[model samples]
Target: MPVAIPLTTHDLNSGGFAAARARTTARMTATVMDLTREIPNIRAYALRTWHEATQRLAEDPEATTAIRAERDRF
Candidate 1:
């Protein structure tokens, strides 16, 4: 997917298209790297929360009824 950015004439005049493109690319690369670094942590958090939720449901006798009621509300 491509995104459009609105730049002023002055911005274009100062550094031109190449400079602007390089800057945008660098920022995007850094953002992707940051998210990549957090993959393991995010996965661990998701798994922990999922386990806790399932455990709670297992302990609650009325979990099925509650889930059905909640689903009907939507």
Candidate 2:
């Protein structure tokens, strides 16, 4: 995510630009950190959903039959 900070000539001359840059950098860093912290949970959810789908395909006889029928049609 890009943040647009509007800077005036006075802000640049008076050194306010540096402070604004630091603040924006800190905010972006914190947002990235927060997203990184959720990686494990996100991975777990994805894996769990994949496993459930696999299990369902394995256990459902109708689905197995349908897949085999489709394959034989080729």
Candidate 3:
């Protein structure tokens, strides 16, 4: 995931530190809640799917050959 670009708020600059802090804190809470959910994360599902596809191709000679030929030209 792409992280948000943080705005610098040095003491010398008149930036809205309070608003920035509040926004960051709120986003952190929301992200943490999402992390705790049981739904499959992006990595896990992708790994599982990749493994299944690989195993299928390995077991089937035709598929394995076709995939190899496609990748050879890819």
Candidate 4:
């Protein structure tokens, strides 16, 4: 089966913005495509957190902040 590529839509209210909006929409589409490639890894990290650590973090916010800081560098 052939996979479908996602397309982002843009709407312009005034003709004055037609040129700028096109450039912006192109940049947005490219960024979205790049970010989407990391969805699986992001999902895995989110799930792994709740496995049990979520409860511990709920038990304490300080430790959670430290862990979050480390993850930000990851």
Tens-place lDDT digits, model 4, residues 1-74: 89987643443455647777788999999999988998999889777765446555556768967467445534
Where model 3 places Cα greater than 4 Å from the true spot, the runs are 1-16, 36-40, 61-74
Backbone-clash count (model 4):
0
- The lDDT of model 4 is 0.69
Across 5-69, the per-residue lDDT of candidate 1 in tens digits comes to 88888777675676888899999999999999999999897777666666665677488864554
Residue-wise C-alpha lDDT for candidate 3, range 1-74, written one tens digit per residue:
99987756565245577678888999999998898783568667766766666666667758766567444433
- Give lDDT: candidate 1, residue 66: 49
- State which candidate, 2 or 4, has the greater TM-score: 2
After aligning candidate 3 to the native by TM-score, how far in Å is the CA of 3 from where it should be? 38
TM-scores of all models? Answer: 0.65, 0.58, 0.41, 0.44
Write down the lDDT of every candidate, Cα atoms only.
Answer: 0.74, 0.74, 0.68, 0.69
Model 3 global lDDT (CA atoms, 0 to 1): 0.68
List candidate 1 segments past 4 Å from native.
Answer: 1-15, 64-74
Q: Comparing candidate 1 with candidate 4, which one achieves the higher TM-score?
A: 1
Worst lDDT run of 10 residues, candidate 3, spans: 65-74
TM-score of 2: 0.58
**Tens-digit lDDT string for candidate 2 (1-74):** 89999977876856767788889999999999999999999989777766666666567757965556444433
Error (Å) of candidate 2 at residue 59 is 1.9
